[model samples]
Target: MGFFDLKAECAICNKQVGLHRFQIANKEWVCPECFKKCGFTAMTPIKTMTASQVQAALQEKEKSAEALKTFVATKKSDHF
Candidate 1:
């Protein structure tokens, strides 16, 4: 009793892809076969980074901000 819907149609071929066997293309549901024939590849992975990379970048920015804060705090007044 674990049925699912599969009535979604492919955008390029205008064919039913059965929901579980299709990919998204330009906001339209497309069958995998047609997706390949259109020379499209998923860019989600390449556009995003891993958690560790994001963490390291955030830490580096924090360190730079702390350095700037200390530098400004200990500065000797040139006027007055």
Candidate 2:
């Protein structure tokens, strides 16, 4: 069997990747052309956070949001 003998489908375009090779991301097959078009050289997972970690992140975001809101309100009042 030759190198091109292998057959697989591209993950991005869902097309056949026979003669032309494809890229693999997280065990997913992707065509070479589609890989370039999709602009993904590497794929990383963002699914390692636990429930409590997620909640902590959300709380931190809310605190920053509140701080920003307070700063904006003070600035708007000073301008008016």
Candidate 3:
């Protein structure tokens, strides 16, 4: 048997897009032309966070926690 072929047209541009360049979104085969017209592009896949960035974020979180603790202590003393 021959290879099965899937034909699909773009929603916005209505152009026939090959299987390789097609993407499924919202239960439809989104072609490149329609994707560009809709201002949607494939995101560049990357790692979540680097070591230094994670450390910096954790430091900021600690600083915020300290500030919140100080605020709670002052508010408790004010009511007493």
Candidate whose TM-score is highest = 1
CA lDDT of each prediction against the hidden true structure: 0.51, 0.51, 0.46
Question: For model 3, how big is the CA root-mean-square deviation?
Answer: 16.0
Q: Judged by lDDT relative to the true structure, which candidate is superior, 2 or 3?
A: 2
TM-scores, one per candidate: 0.37, 0.35, 0.34
Error of 1 at 42 (Å): 2.1
Q: Model 1: residues >4 Å from true position, as ranges?
A: 1-4, 21-27, 44-80
Better of 1 and 3 by lDDT: 1
Scored against the true structure, residue 1 in model 3 reaches a CA lDDT of 12
What is the TM-score (0 to 1) of candidate 1? 0.37
> Per-residue lDDT for 1-80 in model 3, tens only?
11134676544355776664443433345455544433334561112333343335446666877798887443345565
| Candidate 1, 1-80: lDDT as tens digits | 11255476655457777755443323445566654543436743312443344335446666877798888465778799
Error of 1 at 17 (Å): 0.5
User: Per-residue lDDT tens digits of candidate 2, residues 10-29?
Assistant: 55456777856543334445
For model 2, the stretches where C-alpha displacement exceeds 4 angstroms are 1-5, 40-80
